[model samples]
Target: MTASRPDIRTFLCRSDNIGVLLRDPATGACAAIDVPEAGPVLAALDETGWTLTDILVTHRHADHIDGIVEVKRRTGAKVTAPAKAGSAIPAVDVAVSEGDMVRVGSLTAVVWETPGHCADHVTYWFEGPRLIFAGDTLFTLGCGRVMEAEPAVLWRSLARFEGLPDETEVYSGHDYVLSNARFARAAEPDNARLVARMEEAERAKAEGRFLVPTTLGEERATNPFVRAAEPSLARSVDLAPGTEPERVFTALRAWKNKF
Candidate 1:
């Protein structure tokens, strides 16, 4: 039997980080993707009247796990973190690795180790609902800065998402659509889809709305980082037309670092 769609609440935490609450309606099992701050997570729980049953940590980054202790203290939620991060993250009840399945009520998410920005980074893919909590691995039109690994490693991590259905909804860790849109346009100036996406991002920012939960199709169409294999992106980075995709990606990432 098909599972019922889960209820999702997306809110701002700290400055630009995103906080999400995923609740299984049938069983009311709620999970917070990451706790950037306890106050916002608590507030969202209060407003929605949903009890947090699990805290799913994406990586060991402080911005993502800073509030884990407090939120766990208050709600007694089970904390699940990357096995690779081990004790670096606080209050972890479960240490999961690649291919592990995490269940919240009837909802199931397969853990995918998508390291690039950091070695311990993981993305939770809820296949049943076609939703991905991409952490810092991917944003709307951009990807996380390569902090712990080579640019090629990040490219490989991003390649994992290309085969997903176009309608899959991606929930990333931060709100960087406007800046990513700007950089994407510079990388692919003549792309009408990118231009349209940039305009939408601008309007979203103006209205104080977030351009998150972006569909995979939208990312494929407009995200330059993911489209590094295209000859145009190679040319934007001053690489030859037939350059290797990985090299093209590296150059694009280098350019984006300064952009």
Candidate 2:
């Protein structure tokens, strides 16, 4: 890849919201993660002088994929969505699942079935860029609302993200830094890493910087849900001092829901 090559850039479309734009310099084929609002996607396409080649949808939520129709109509871009979500996304060119792979110019995305937020939600992960379009499955500091599944299912779905390299950049549907930080504190009051991350996120957002694409390493260190086994987190959740991992994990998530 050349230095002049276009890249994947995440833009803030609203307070605690994001729209990921993927720029394929080789073909000038731009693709968006979720189309919360068309304006930001159009703005990114305009700025890059590229045409949209595809719209990658994770689920059926309006916030996650309402712009599919307009975007495809305007650009004739293909829409790729989970096999079950195809109905909501008109003219789906590709229906994917856990083992499928999707292509965009020279880029390839592997699909992961992350179904707690919605049973059909599927995250798309690109190789070279090492980016994961997590949608509402995972957030910087919190997981998506467990609307269609149990906490156990969500925990498992989120855990699927654990093996990606520590440097994997997570691009989520929303910028939930502040609320997530508060939850992190309640989950792990004594976590020095969480403390620092909360303050850092506050200052960064205060300065108008986007607070997403948090690395797996950063999340492991600062995210409370992922670190539910930590002693501080167990204590914060009111679990017995030496509670088993399973019990603590359950308690921690319950605590966060209240936070």
* RMSD of every prediction: 0.7, 2.1
Q: On a 0 to 1 TM-score scale, where does candidate 1 land against the true structure?
A: 0.99
TM-score of each: 0.99, 0.92
In TM-score terms, candidate 2 sits at 0.92
| lDDT per residue as tens, model 1, 1-259 | 7789999999999999999999999999999999999999999999999999999999999999999999999999999999999889998999999999999988999999999999999999999999999999999999999999899899999999988999999999999999989999999999999999999999999999989989999999999888888889999988998889899889888888998
- lDDT by residue (1-259, candidate 2, tens digit) is 4333448777877555698888777777778887877777788888877788988888888776666777778888888889977687666888998989987787788999998888888998876778888988888988787788777787788888888899888888888888899988876777788898888998998898867889889989988777766777677767767766556666666666776
Off by over 4 Å in 1: none
Candidate 2: residue pairs that collide? 16-175
